[model samples]
Target chain A: MSFVSYLLNGISLGSVYAIIALGYTMVYGIAKMLNFAHGDVIMIGSYVAFVAINSMGLPIPVAILLSVAACTLLGVTIERVAYKPLRHASKLAVLITAIGASYFLQNVALLIFGANTKSFSSVVKMQPIQLAGGQLNITGETIVTVAACIVIMICLMAFMKYSKAGHAMLAVSEDGGAAQLMGINVNGTIALTFAIGSALAAIAGVLLCSAYPSLTPYTGAMPGIKAFVAAVFGGIGSIPGAFIGGILLGVIEILGKAYISSQLADAIVFAVLIIVLVVKPTGLLGKQIQEKV
Target chain B: MKKLSKTTKSSLITYGIVVFAYIFCEIFMRTGHMSSLLKGILVPLCVYVVLAVSLNLTVGILGELSLGHAGFMCVGAFASAVFSKCMMETITVPTLRFALALLVGVVCAGVCGVLIGIPVLRLRGDYLAIVTLAFGEIIKNLVNVIYLGVDSNGFHVSMKDAMSLQMEPDGLVIIKGAQGITGAPTDSNFTIGVVLVLITLVVVTNLVHSRTGRAIMAIRDNRIAAESIGINITKYKILAFSISAALAGAAGVLYAHNLSTLTALPKNFGYNMSIMILVFVVLGGIGSIRGSMIAAVVLTLLPELLRSLNEYRMLIYAVVLIATMIFTWSPSAIGFRERYSPAKLFHKREKGVQ
Candidate 1:
């Protein structure tokens, strides 16, 4: 029963990671660049939601909507101002620029929010569920988080499969030049990807804060990196890969903390990633491309 | 002197600059012209220069992005600090102890580099970058949990807390888990730092212009072509990475020795530091050794320079970072430079003279 509870907790945590990883994987796939700022966008989302609820006296759902809208706009703006100029530049340049953007966002947040850690009020109002004569209790945040993750994942998959914009995204990811030649607006598609990814980031931010209930300028950094690892673990360019990778990573992290030394949990998780990458360089779901002479 | 080669001339200038800076700083200190703040940053400035230059070896010359350079530095720092602590009484001479500790730090970091590189180098591009990042975090996380003590019955280590070490009554705890090592001798100084910086510059600059350096660059330019031309890709990659790691380790030694308490904080040894070093390399101009040194010094000092603006310091720094990237790499900026470059004007003046 305790193991079952741990697994549930892992899934809930993993669900948040998956949501963030989805943003990372999508941006990487479409733009062929890592948006290091994507993590900070999550931080911004949380802050926005926090302000909306606490200061503005807005309802939870309204605050969430506002956060999502703000993040989407911010993502598109970041893409245009910081990233678009580096489209034809080297991957390294784009990465550095993304990093710069990340620092910019973090500093801005720091200046506005100060360095204090805010105890976030949970947005989820659902009642806790008890099982096995109340020995195992699952919090409302966990249920909402897991449910939100699954719903988001399913909707993303279906949208990518059927929507026109999604097909354009697929085409761009496949080959930007070819897609451009085929009359697809590669830039537009990339922006849309950013918009959608940022929206998901906002949701992930809310869920993350609700579960962990702490907010800071750096709240998203570690989780962002972990989700990125998850994205790579499952297979970088694949959607389903991010899901499986996030869940597995979360489970490993939780179980490692439970069974092994909690202090070494992060080490154990990273070590496993190294081993997995050694076994499969492209990642579990990542496609292998032959070198061209 | 008879006309020196371009590489030779550049290398000479680089050495000249370091020596000149050291002499300049020493004179300032003697004349009481340097501020306490500037004086304090002198050693750390050297450390950053070394880090920036060493990381340039991998990111600039070798063309592989490593996000775990700080992990190597952490390994180097903790190894040296541990050694220094354990030998505090046994080793009577500070100089000898410090040198041995330095060697231990370098060797440990280099070995870790090789171990990490062997498996990690198998992956390419972003995959390789991510793996390095993972290794770096792993190193930091593991270091945070480590508990080490030394007594009459040799050394004892435990991943648990300090109490779990079960050392003898007279045992001294060198490392107390998250609390980290305290009381390590401060054997580092601005002079030693500058010397190490010079040493690192010589090694890295020489490697960049050597036959192996050419081979490494060739691999970076075109891996397939280099492999076809009989270049040992795996060997060179590992060699460059490990050497770079060793240099970073040396920087870590300087860093560790300068402080009384040495802890592997994320701010110091995490991916952020690695990224900061990378920023130096990129902003300086990738593959340009002198540029890296200059960039490291300027960027490290910039925040201090902007201390008056306190709240806006990092904000301005970020803006500068973004602006520099755009200026350096954006297509319009490149075109603008080509159109109005000083080199082109100089060439035109020579043509007119002819």
Candidate 2:
């Protein structure tokens, strides 16, 4: 493939990462905890969509809707059942609980799904767009994924900036105690944050499954981790930073696969993160945090 | 003279584990009713014990969360495997070679620890966790691409295909990229694994009680205060981390030697394995050595014990993990622990004095 095609592939992949990273950054920003189960949420979303389309014989659009709704509910339920009780617990405890929830979700999927990889039908059906007199080609799936990501990013930014619920989320993220004192329901705002994040994970999961064409109980794990790295790379709590980091990481990963060793692409991606973090602990766009004595 | 003392608590627990493990193995061996499946898990159980205890040093004692422990294990496994493969012809005796391989594995893992510690020890909290996670992934992937061969001319290492090794026609391939080291002597057994576990427990417990161990704990409890008190934070951090890595490597050697065919996979030495060890550390209660040992053995054996559950085994394990975390850390549970602490038995004597 030509360099442009490789770059295009990277862009498409990066958009997916950006979408997933948004969920991670948003939840981390508000809840002050890494939702380790976020990836498994994506897995659950894909399974839901798969079941809606193939098993229930639903249309593509309705399948997407059902998947998103299921994910939102799952996200809210997890936060209530697993996370809420540990609200005042140690950081280590909260983190372990998140890991446990992650394993719980994955294992539940494994038991139900039997550790098999299911083929997913693409929701977007269109011919490949040929470029440079058929020397290069790009799938319609790529175009839709990239465009959808851009649209979602813009909508998210606008919602955070203008909407009342968005304002409440921001307030809670800034200071939960202060937000509670100001008549905002802190738990409700946090729950809404999870809902939105889970919905976004669903979108990312669908696009990822469509592009990859195979769905398994663990399909969401690697992408979830990479997106998290992107969020951290751009700045863990910054939405715009997550967007930028996700794209950059995708581009670098694809380019490395093309030019360098394809097998070592993951190592390169992580090495870059280690270097960037060593140089800037808060990430590129993250604000400086001062630890109080 | 028959009465228990405060210091004896740790030794009692330590000796208890060793003695109990010995008796358990003896009973299982002597009895014909025990399943072969349960017998096979003994070595793995001991390996997990060492892993959990070593990981506790970094997570519990040093107060830093490292998610790349499996990387150290991977390093040790490959290092020992390669060393044994190279010395196959030179060392005719299996026992001597296994002992030498263990040393090589421990030292190599320790070196890797120091190397990773230098860059990683600077970061704190979640960032440290992520970096170590990245390191673990990198090591696993790197192992996938590595090609090592042995021949009359000595060792040959390459990243490409076996042909790239450029060895003589009869050269033996040690690590064939993804196919890992093959034909390495399977010298590990329950007895050796138990010895390693005992060594790990003794070393970690001693370090926890020693002055250096206290300094490490101080760093964990409060880094700023530890530094204020003129503690060499870097020295202690590296020391604890390296020691942890070395022990993990020892466990890896045991693991590598036990299996006939060893390959580096995500399920084996990847993120999943790292998280599994961390589960043991966290569930056991941080800073509690005996707690880690008990947690490791129980968690390792839980699935085996629930063999009848079949497919539902992992699901049950997950629930147990979630439940354990919630119970151990929740505030209400704190009340239960305070009231029912093991020291409560001595409360009657204290009440008489009062």
Candidate 3:
């Protein structure tokens, strides 16, 4: 592939990461907890889509809808069951519970699906567009993933800005106690945040699997972690930061693999994280807050 | 006077648990009445015990969450494995070689601990967690790329491939790229593992009771106050973290020597392994040494005991994990524990007798 195609690949991959990071940032913004299980929700969405399309013989669109709806429900249920009780608990406790929920989701997928990688047919079937005298080609999947990510970002921004529910989410995220006092049902907004995040996870899952073309119980794990790193890199809880962070991480990862040693790509990526963290803990675009006594 | 007696009482109980474990393993081994599966897990159970206890030093005592203990273990495993491989011809005695290798592993891992702790410990909370996690990943990845071999001509290092190892015809390959160390001596046994566990317990419990330990806990409980009280925060944090790393390295040596073929697969020393260790620490109740030990041994053996359940084993493990966290940390569970705790009953009995 030419340099252009490689950059395109990175853009496509980064867009998928951005979608996943949105879930993380949304949940973190609203709940003040890292939804570690959010990654596994991607896995769940992919599996649900797989079953709907391949096993149940449903159309691709219906399968996509099923995946999104299932993930939305799963996300809400997880928040209610595992996270709700621990809302007032220690951060460490909530973090561990999130880890537990992540573990639970992965293992349940393993139990149901077994520890095997499943081949997933491309959701978006279109001819690859040849460019630069056939030197550069972009697949339909890549186009769809990138386009859909942009659309989602726009929709999310508009929703957060204009929608009443979105405004409620913003209020809850700012201060749950204050929002509750303002008669904005804190739990409901939090639940809505999870639903929206998980629904995005479904889109990300399908797009990611389409690009990668393989699905395992752990397919979401590395991407999940990388997306989280992206979120952190962009400054956690900032939507645009997540967007830019995801793209930048993706480009760096792709370019590192293309130029540097493939084995060292993950290390290089993490090394960048260390450097960023050491230099600026709040990450790019993150606001600084004074430490309170 | 009561406090002194209470310290003795707790130490006595700690020793009692160790003795009980040793005897139980001994009886199982000598009797041979139990399944081979039980015997097989003894060494691993002990390794997990050491790992859990040492991790408790950072997570529980230091009040910093480190998700990179496995990375330290990985460092120790490879360092010790390389040492043993290099000394294979020179040192004929397996026992002596294993002991020397263990020392080497501890030093290497402890050095890694200090190196990682210095820069990473400056950050706190989630940032610290992710950075340490990154450090762990970096170490794991570096080990995979790093190739070390030993021959009569001495050690040859390479990064690209094994063919870069231009050594004498009989040069022993020690860390092949991704393939890891092979033909390693399996010197780990139930007895040695138990001894390591005891050593870990002694070190950790002593540290927890010492003045340094008090300062460390104080830092964990309230860093600002600890700093105000003139505790050298960085010194104590690094001291606790490196010690924890050193202990994890010791566990790594035990684990590396236990297996004939030690591969640096992500499964062995990756994020998953790190998370699992954290789970042991968290589920055992943060900062509770004995709790970590019990949780480690039980959780390790739980899957093995449930082997007959096959697919249900991990499912059950997940349920138990979530349930344990809920019960241990949930508000309702706190209420339950406060009412029915054995320690409370013991305190009541002592008061009555007085």
Candidate 4:
């Protein structure tokens, strides 16, 4: 593949990771709990899409909306059920709960849907776009998918940066107690954070399904880790940083496929993550804050 | 909690596990058909106890959530399989082969544990979780690619005629390509597994009760405070990790020998196993050794009990796990704190209480 092709692929794939990552980073930023189930939210989103498309027989647009809606609701359900009760528990317990939720989701998906891989049939695959050279050929699905991700991400970023709800989220994430004292409903902001992250995960599921049609119960597993890595790479709590990190990670992974042994490709991505963590745990855009003794 | 000598407590748990195993085997014989199913459940139960306890050392005791025990188990499984296969020709005794295989597996896993532990020791909090998760994927992926076949087909003896077998000294039998190692002696019995699990429980319990274990739990409670008091955080983390790895290695051997069919699949040792084992530790309550064993057995038996649910087994598990997580998490639930807590149990009450 050409460098441009690699870059395009990286940015597109990375955006999906960034979308999934935003959920992880924001939750971690606010709660200091690793939501292992966040990855499974993407899995759940794909299933919601499966239900909307297969069972409901809704229009593609309606199906996407339904998936996103279901994901948002489920996100809140998780917070309420798994997280809300554990707020006062040791942070490790919350983390363990998240893992339990993650395993629970994947297993449930397996039992309900069967372990066989499902493919989302597409009418968009036939239309292939020809680039300037014969060397590069992009499909219609890829184009729409990438473009949709960029637009959704921009909207999400805007919502976080300017909206009152977003500012409240920022305040609560910074200091939940202080934010509560300042008349901000910290719990409400957290629920909103989950909602936004979940909605993005649903979008990511749709895009991933389009790019790679097969959807397994565990499909979100790898991307979950990679996106979190991306989030960490850019700065765990930073939205734009997640975007940049995701794209950069995607590009590196793809380019490594060509320049390095593909067998070690995944390892290299994580190796870089470790190196980055060792050098700067707070990440590029994140400022270091000393934990209060 | 009353105080008992470490050696005595260890012996008690060990003997208790052995007696429990005999009774369990009696129940298995009483359950009638589907003996394989019973064995399957028993095997994983025994194995998972070790895995959960080993993982608890890191996630529970060491104050780091490392999701890589499955990776170490993978190392153990492969190492055990290789060791047994290599010894197949030289060691004709089936039982001895099994014993040696497990021994080799545990050692290999322990070495790998230490190797991986070095860099990860520096990490703490969720950063440790992410790094361990990454390391797990790396190990699994690497194993998926690396394989060495058994040189059983008479060593090809100068690559004789293309269509012919190279005989002369020995018979032709070849280890297949990434086809999975098969036909190992059925060396893993329920008794062996229970013994190992019991041994692991005792060893781990003793370690946890030891000064080292207390130091680990203290670190888990408050890293800075523990460090301030002169606890070598990284050293204890590594020690706990290596022990965890060794236990997981022993479990891997059990899994490999009992299952017979072995393949290098990353997916097998993937995040799900890690998470499942962690749930066992969490559900049982971290820092509680007996709790770890109980949770492991319960979670292990749960899927079996739900077998009647057929396809709904996992859905039921999800419900059960979620419900239990909620139940344990609720502040009103008294023992819930005891079950899921990773903190040190000791408390220095106020002067007025005395």
Which runs in model 3 stand beyond 4 Å of their true positions?
A: B1-4, B332-354
> Which one is best on DockQ?
1
Measured with C-alpha atoms, the lDDT of residue A7 in candidate 4 is 74
Comparing 1 and 2 by DockQ, which wins? 1
Clashing pairs in 2: none
The residue-by-residue lDDT of candidate 3 on B1-354, one tens digit each, is: 455667657876987898897997798778887788787888888889999999999999999988888999999998998888777788999889989999999999999999989999998877788888898899999999988877898889998898889989998778888888898888889889988999899999998999999999999989899899899999999999999999999999999999988887788899889888988888888888899999898889899989999888877887787777678667887898998899998999999999
- Steric clashes per prediction: 0, 0, 0, 1
Give a tens-digit lDDT track for model 4, residues A157-205.
7987899998898888888899999999888888888888888889888
Fnat per candidate: 0.84, 0.68, 0.66, 0.49
lDDT of 4 by residue, B1-354 (tens): 889977677668756865776686767677874466775677777788878878777766776777777888988888888777767789998778988998899999999989888887776666677778777877776665553443445244222222244344434333332345677666787778777877887788778778988998898788889999999988887888898888888888888888777765655687667777888888888766677778888877887888887877766776777677667666866475675555523332344366
Q: What's model 4's overall lDDT? A: 0.78
Model 1 pairs in collision:
none
Least accurate 10 contiguous residues by lDDT in model 3 chain B:
B1-10
**Candidate 2 residues B1-354, lDDT tens each?**
588867668667776868787887878788876678988888998889999999999999999999899999999999999888778889988778889999999999999999999988999887898999999999999999999887789889999889999999888888989988888888888888888888888898888888999999999889999999999999999999999999999999999989877889998899889989998888888878888888898999998889899988887887787777778777777778887887985896799899
The runs of at least 3 residues in candidate 1 whose Cα sits more than 4 Å from the true structure, single-residue gaps closed, are B1-3, B340-354
Compared with the true structure, all predictions reach lDDT values of 0.93, 0.91, 0.90, 0.78
- Candidate 3's displacement at residue B116, Å, is 0.9
Instruction: Report the TM-score measured on chain A for model 4.
Output: 0.94
